[model samples]
Target: MAQTTDLDLVHVIKRFGSHTAVNDVSFSVAPGEFFSILGPSGCGKTTLMRMIAGFEDPTSGDIRIRGKSMIGVPANKRPVNMVFQSLALFPMMSVGENVAYGLTSRGVSRAEAEERAGRMLERVGLKGFGNRRVTALSGGQRQRVAIARCLVLEPTLVLLDEPLGALDLKLREHMKIELKQLQATFNTTFAYITHDQSEALVMSDRIAVMNQGRFEQVGSPRELYHHPATPFVASFVGETNKWQGEAAGAAPDGTVAIRLPSGTMVKGQGRVADRATLAFVRPEAIALAQDSSSLGGLPNRFEGRVSAVLFDGANSSLLIDAAGFDEPVRAVLPQAGPLAGIQVGAPIHVGWTVEAMKVFAA
Candidate 1:
């Protein structure tokens, strides 16, 4: 990997009158690493990206590339390029012209610009589409063209703002693999923004989960998956079951016990406090059984009637209605091997391993 240098942000804040779009948020990116800032529509991920690209100036704080500060640098003067969500490709221009736009703006000659443009197109899997009109290209081709234009500049860093949000599911999946490979081949730092958690998990070396202009957690995919730092992350990362309870005793082995209103004590692993409010358990961790729930060995267990069953190829998603644990406790059963005679309307017990239970305060 060709590392450029570290990119740093210090107390970066963006405000619009009294509303702060981006609070005092800060994070860093390692050169040549794929880092993603993920959150919902108004979470300020895109706002931070624009500020870094110089399209918008931070109201306060500072941003640095390598070791040089970039407080007031103009967009074009920065050693960075961005592929906008709308792509911003010129409609009147041809495919080759669109790719060579950056080069021409930088004073490259027409002949050299055209040649380099063709090569860049080829690099992004659009080899011979150069002579065609930009309008003639497909959505995926347009995306590649946008990427090629940015890459042609060979900047120290690249900002991709939801580049794959426009493509279909199958194309989006394929492009995810291609985009990761493309970044490695270019060996440039990539600071991408997306609202899709699955996309962030699949593409990034590290993910920063943001909420309301603040980062809720930052870690690698597996770390965020198995050990979410917040309730928002645990519920948002993937499908999870949540319960409201209060701490009842001391957990010697790091397993906190939360007592429900019905006197049911659900013991599991989490940071427990005297007034703990929430418990999180991933659906995949919960299992359905006909025998005893083994609640003593499990952190949480509930007896319920099967409400629904959905067979999704490799796994079957089960929904059970249980007392004290409302909202339909769910579980995943193996597809190749069903859980033997389990059906809707059958009485069953739902259980989860102690380690599978995640407790969070509030």
Candidate 2:
């Protein structure tokens, strides 16, 4: 027998007066999968999440949870729960009370609710924390409390809308792994929406990259990073240096060339020909050397001076003002390599293979 999906949206469209918030969006999340909708702010990711949470209704199409239509079903009646950015925990309530609120409201009985809430608190690494005030916990602790509150309901799907947006950088990083672990522990479907690409890349089983109220691409992290289907997906999913140019047709080896405004020619793999095009090259893909000899006759080699050095430990990089490119090209700096200590204003050679580039029509 075919297994039913945990959540599914079919050709869903949502509009507010003249503006279409979500346009013909469709996708499905398998049982226990951690799926994320990734996009920039106002790209309609939040609107889509709201629709799934029953806060907003789609103008067209259907939303299904565990094989049943959710049309006209109120938020409270749906077999789903949402954890918002603010968490919205009651300030006056104790941690236990906040977690047991939904159960008590449903008449689960005070003793049963407390027992369930206590077990859930321990499951989230907060044993003996139920009697503590919600205001006394740290940011990460509060985040887990919020998640535990929702997970205790054992809903079919859990919708998270930028739940970590309020945390500091260090805590947010810690919480990402924790959230993934918690989701796995429960094996419940998670439909997360986030504007931060790093969050989606780190935590999602599959990501749907949305833009301008439509899905740009949907694939695994590796597939999206190595084989982007659209320009928006390429630029939005990761850090890439973008260059505008004109397509110079394909080479005999099936690689397409792009002619930059500086009259420099570069080759990459793409189908765009004889039109305005954009080329993308990742910082780590470019090989940097003191001289071109180290690059061994690479097809795309440029001599330039280091315009700046950005240091982030293992993620350090150098900005090169390469010849023939309008903006500086960034190259990764290995922490233990010979070029690791290279300084600004140093002459450098940067090169890459045609395989490292991605070209698309503008």
Candidate 3:
């Protein structure tokens, strides 16, 4: 069975004079799915969102919602709602009034609007607080109110533009879970855009990694993390140690050997076409060995002196100055192991398998 597409963009291109913001991008969102566009600033993610919301017209291509064209539709006429980073909840109105604003504007009876607002508040876990002033609510409560305000209108798609960007670190972490729960509870299609990889990975069913003015890759969090399609996607989606090198040639086992500028030979699994290649090994993929023998039969091995210990609780890592490499190699240390107490200037062995190294043509 083919699942209904809630939103579809066909070769969408948005250009400003000579500069193109979004260049021939196309994708679709399944009904009730939580999709996210993740990228750095000025990556055209927000511009794409604005186009979908009808605020800006695309220079080319088409946008459809529920199989209906949205090319000529106005912002207010679209069956979509946008929740901004600021939330934009009305401080002057009571929580109930704020949530009912859209319904009341559409000629719904005041009593009916209030009744629906109350139910919506309950659904968002703010039960019995409709009559309270918006100023009295906490940050997370205010976010829920903003969402309720949009949901009250029964929009087919909800666009959240970095809705958690304004919250503190702890609150943002807490709200990520709450936001996913709310989205699941409603079973509504959510198109989220954010620069935070953690937020996108934690909440999205699938993520579109955007760079410059286009999507570099789109996949589930695990797929993007484990098998990034491009060098940008590999470097942007997570923490990794990247080294630039030239392709030395392919080995019998199909692993391509790369000769780094530092004259270090490292082998990785990938198609090596371009002579200029970039290799990425995730911090967690490199294992620290007490001795050369501890590396077993790993293909790539190096000895280095510990330069620094980055302590982040269970996420502690080590910065090692490996011989023949100008840059330090970062490797994750086990939370509790014999190497946990490794100190600066201590000599250590680090090694990784060819499969753990992702090689891409630069």
Tell me each candidate's TM-score.
Answer: 0.93, 0.98, 0.98
Quote the RMSD, in angstroms, for model 1: 2.3
For candidate 2, which ten residues in a row score worst on lDDT? 248-257
Candidate 1: segments with Cα more than 4 A from true spot: 1-4, 293-299, 340-342
lDDT of 1 by residue, 163-281 (tens): 89988988898888888988988877899899998889998999999889888998998899899988899888877888888987756787887886666788877766657668888
Q: What is the lDDT of candidate 1?
A: 0.85
lDDT of predicted model 2: 0.93
Q: What TM-score quantifies how close candidate 1 is to the native fold?
A: 0.93
Model 2 over residues 280-355: C-alpha lDDT tens digits? 9999999888888999877899999999999988888889999999999988886876888899999999999998
Any runs in candidate 2 off by more than 4 Å, and if so which? Answer: none
Clashing pairs in 1: none
The residue-level lDDT of candidate 2 at 33 comes to 97
lDDT of 3 by residue, 204-275 (tens): 999999988899999999999999999999999989999999999987776999999989999998887889
Error of 3 at 165 (Å): 0.9
Candidate 3 C-alpha error for residue 192, in Å: 0.5
